[model samples]
Target: MLISLSRVIKGYLLSALLGVVIGSLIGMSRTINELLLPMITVIRQIPMIAWIPLIILWCGIGEESKVVIIVLAAFFPILVNAESGIAQTPESFLEVARLYKLGWWKTFSKVYLPHAIPQILVGLKLGLGVSWMAVVASELIAATSGIGYRMSNARSLMRPDIVIVCMLVIGIVGILMDKAIGIIFELFTPWVEKKRRD
Candidate 1:
């Protein structure tokens, strides 16, 4: 369980960082969006599992393969949400930034990022869920250790109790991960929370 959790965290962080950067670039650049959007859409349409075999072939059945699978699983939703969020930034906010004669960096930091926080949080939450699911699936098919591997082994040994225990562990861990993200989101976006309460 610990192994799987670590892998999930690592994969989630990597994918989330890359997703945000790439998504922001896509949102900011019409030419890049036009060039890459269709390809991204097509890739996102493919099932996560369908890539398992190819991932295994390329990365082998090691930890790398599993991590890659989790990254792929978590990447698309995050990218989509982040891009959408940035794109949806109010024109009024941009106008205000322009009126202030803010540089591109200042405009993005003070205006775009603040406005996009809520949607980015949503994407992170979704990405976390997908990361957990992907890590478990990858472990089940390829890992020698981890909660999923333990459950797989238990199934082969006819120990339903072990499988059930593993499932519970996974569920509890997932909940904790999500709650952690929520807390971080609130911390970073206190204004949003305040508005909601009002």
Candidate 2:
């Protein structure tokens, strides 16, 4: 039950990218934080499956619903990580940037993002795992196609082996996806590697 690598990569990238965008907005804006804090808290408290009924009602078991579900699962982690990472950037670094007469853009690109790389990746990793699981949850509840739906069909057919195989497929794919992201992060963020080594 191997899925195409291209499709898997596309799904992972799309979910992570969308999650980062929303997370960044949420992390940066006091107004949004105030508005969404309660909503996010509530959503976080509920299991991903709890939303399936409502999602189905609104999106009709389509791709939109599944994407929304994954987004919901993914967005919070990336946002929280990025915000915390940015916040954690040393005040000393800010001062150094200012002393250098660096513009806001330069300061962010140089002093902020590099320092935040580890934390940002942490969030991305967490969000990706959650999104993968959320995809299965969404498929199990609503979608006609997906590994989760496949498992469900197997159960209906009383084929325990098929269910086990599908579960293995999801697990292996999820692990490989996370590993790929980790490798990419390491490749792109040598500063993080140096810090860890030190």
Candidate 3:
């Protein structure tokens, strides 16, 4: 699951960015907030577990359904964090970027993105961890294959050792995924390291 998901980092980042932009637009305009916030609030309140049955029904017990649930579980944290990071970007940086006549794209990539990388990475790490967990919970409920299914089967068959092994595997994989994201963030945003020193 982690390996497959790693391939979707660009997709995850794009989706998260879109979420932030849209959410902030709504947040900034109180009119939109009154219209849209309740819908988002309702969706946010729906537990990932509670969505399993409906997701399975709507999407079927296939890879598609599982992936959808994972996205739902992972999306909100990254969305909220990205929005906050973007909206809270220091006004000084925006002023500097504007003074230099940086185009919107360059300003975003060179200034905003670099500045927001740490917070965005934090959200990604959290989202990935939760997605990993959601995948397992999902597989246990309906999947015939996957580590979660394996663990569930082991538990049902009274194989405690196998269950323990599965738990250890899940923990190790989750930790490694988070560490990998951290390394990537550090590599791409060396400025973050310099900022910490001051």
Name the candidate that leads on TM-score. Answer: 1
Which ranking of candidates, highest lDDT first?
1, 2, 3
lDDT (0 to 1) per candidate = 0.90, 0.75, 0.74
Candidate 1 residues 108-153, lDDT tens each? 8898888888888889899999998898888888888888899899
TM-score of each: 0.97, 0.85, 0.83
RMSD of 2: 2.6
Cα lDDT of model 1 overall? 0.90
In terms of lDDT, the best-performing candidate is: 1
After superposing candidate 1, which stretches have Cα over 4 Å from the reference?
none
Q: Where does model 3 exceed 4 Å of error?
A: 1-38
List model 2 lDDT by residue over 100-152, tens digit each: 99986788789878888888899988887787777777777776777878888
The residue pairs in collision within model 3 are none
Worst lDDT 10-window in candidate 2: 1-10
